[model samples]
Target: MRTVDLEVVRGLYKKAGAARLKLDIAPRFKPGDRVKARNINPPGHTRLPRYVRGREGVVERDHGVFHLPDARVAGQDDRPQHIYSVRFSAQELWDAEAPSEDSLNIDLWDDYLDSA
Candidate 1:
């Protein structure tokens, strides 16, 4: 049996860390921008949640560039896109009877959102 070296594993993790930090492109929406999630129901895999689809929210923060998971899963190139934390009120996502104080925050890629 072949034994793996600890240093080799550490190097692999280091490379991954560097890759995650590489934000070469500019972001479309900034913090406080209003955006809506696209109502796309693709037959294939997607990182977007069903509840968030067609919902409108305010951008809370920018998470910088990262690989688009939906495309990556399809054996395509790592097409990095800006990810943002969007805040949605309960009333915006659910029925009007939902608690006014309740809200949801989700991290969404650029492609999933549109200017609201």
Candidate 2:
């Protein structure tokens, strides 16, 4: 077993501090745009919640570019995409009897959304 020195560990961390994705393209949907979540069930890891699948929502805000977590987790390419805050009415996601006034906000990447 090799014992790594403290200075080497500190240097490595310093070089990798808070890395963020770099993207030159702009986001697709902005705030107030209507969008729908794609109904997908990949065999491996995914960040999209099952409850929000195939549901419609409005884009609430642009959260900037980020490395897609799903791909990264599966050891695939860390594609940078714009993330947005999507707001969905409780009634739309749950049963018809759910409160219409209530809403749920979820952050989703671009590839998971489509025009509603």
lDDT of each: 0.89, 0.89
Task: Please give each candidate's TM-score.
Answer: 0.84, 0.82
Tens digit of lDDT per residue, candidate 1, span 52-116? 99999999999888898888888898789899999999999997999998999999999899999
Report the Cα lDDT for residue 28, model 2. 88
Clash numbers, per candidate = 0, 0
lDDT of 1 at 1: 54
Model 2, poorest ten-residue lDDT window? 13-22
List candidate 1 segments past 4 Å from native.
1-6, 10-19
Best by TM-score: 1
**Candidate 2 residue-wise lDDT, 1-116, digit = tens:** 65889976787766553445666868989999999999999888788999999999999998888888899988989878999999999999997899879999999999899989
TM-score computed on alpha carbons, candidate 2 = 0.82
After aligning candidate 1 to the native by TM-score, how far in Å is the CA of 12 from where it should be? 5.9
- Total clashes, candidate 2? 0
CA lDDT, candidate 2, residue 82: 93
